[model samples]
Target: MLEILTGAGLTTSAGLNAFIPMFALGLLDRFTNLVNLPEAWAWFSSDVSLWVVGVLLVLEVVADKIPGVDAMNDAVQTVVRPAAGGITFASGIGTETTTVRDPDALFAGGAWVPIAIGAAIALVVHLAKAGTRVGANTVTVGTAAPVLSTAEDVSAAALTLTALFLPVLVAVLVVAVVVGLWLLARRFRARRTRGRAAAAPGGSEWTA
Candidate 1:
């Protein structure tokens, strides 16, 4: 149960930043005894894989800070992030270091539940993040994109770290972020409606 929560937490973090949680997991698996990734997932901790993902992570951070580019990046990540979430969740859940003969072996027994849950959680959060970015682009004219992107990166990192220990907190934070984005979307739509109404030919105020 706790393992499932922890994996879910990491999946939520992945929705915000696709590679960070995986990178973090890889780093942890390599340097510390805190985690033991399955043999299939051991590549995530390899030097080459780490270096490659690290470079991509750097690129992702940079690209996400740019306004127009960030939206495009979000569109690309709409697929990648959720997929990463599934992989991360599956790897995390399957890290028990058990044999195929073990009845409790999650990976060996083909546990799809965590993978599906993780992907679902990630997709929802990804939608929230992408929607919020689109809303910011619409309302702020790209001025807020860098700041928001930075905030998202920080949030993803924080959530990734927290998921290793306090997954329940990650769940709460994900919910809060989703709700916040939904509210922002509503506000953005309302403002756009008002603006359009005021611009219409008959929308102008009349004088006696």
Candidate 2:
């Protein structure tokens, strides 16, 4: 189970790492009586519900592709994801119930571990992708870069759903997509930079 969680964390970080913590929190909420809201969210009602997980997974993918919309989504999700991850981790620590015997104690006991793990994974994923975006924007003034980012968003969503539904297949696919995207984005950036440099005045060493 630890191995599975670790692998899932890595794969999720590749795309929707920003939301992994939130998803984890949602999972936590299902196990313990930490948050009343998880109970309200039908999809997060049960840990074993494939349908709900699948829907959330799909949303993660869609959220990644909405052009400038992802920036807004990221801002909103930064807080939401960690909260969700905390909730999921808390839920995973115990069983669901209308009331928790000792909410503070239970949270302190075993809930923090998974929440920390999930949040760490999410932070790494967001940083990597955010770095990539910053590099891309520096090279290309935020033009069609959103298209590539959108692709990554979709990939993240697919990987999440696939990991839940078909772990083995998704693992292979995620690795392939990540490698492919990295190469493609690098090449695209290089070409754009070269083109920009060429269009400028003095060869590739101009000041402005």
Best by lDDT: 1
Q: Please, what are the lDDT tens digits per residue for candidate 2 over residues 1-208?
A: 3224323533344334444433543554556454333232445545555446556656766765555655666666666555554444433333222332322333345545756765555554455565566556556556555576666655665664454334456457646765765776676667667777777877664422
Off by over 4 Å in 2: 2-43, 46-69, 72-109, 137-141, 192-196, 199-201, 204-208
lDDT by residue (1-208, candidate 1, tens digit) is 5566567778888998999999998998898876677787899999998999899899899999998999889999989899889988887666542211121354445667667778888888899888878877777788878888888888888877776756557678777667766887788767666766777887743311
Taking all chains together, each candidate's TM-score versus the true structure is: 0.85, 0.53
Off by over 4 Å in 1: 96-108, 202-208
Ten residues in sequence with the least summed lDDT for candidate 2:
95-104
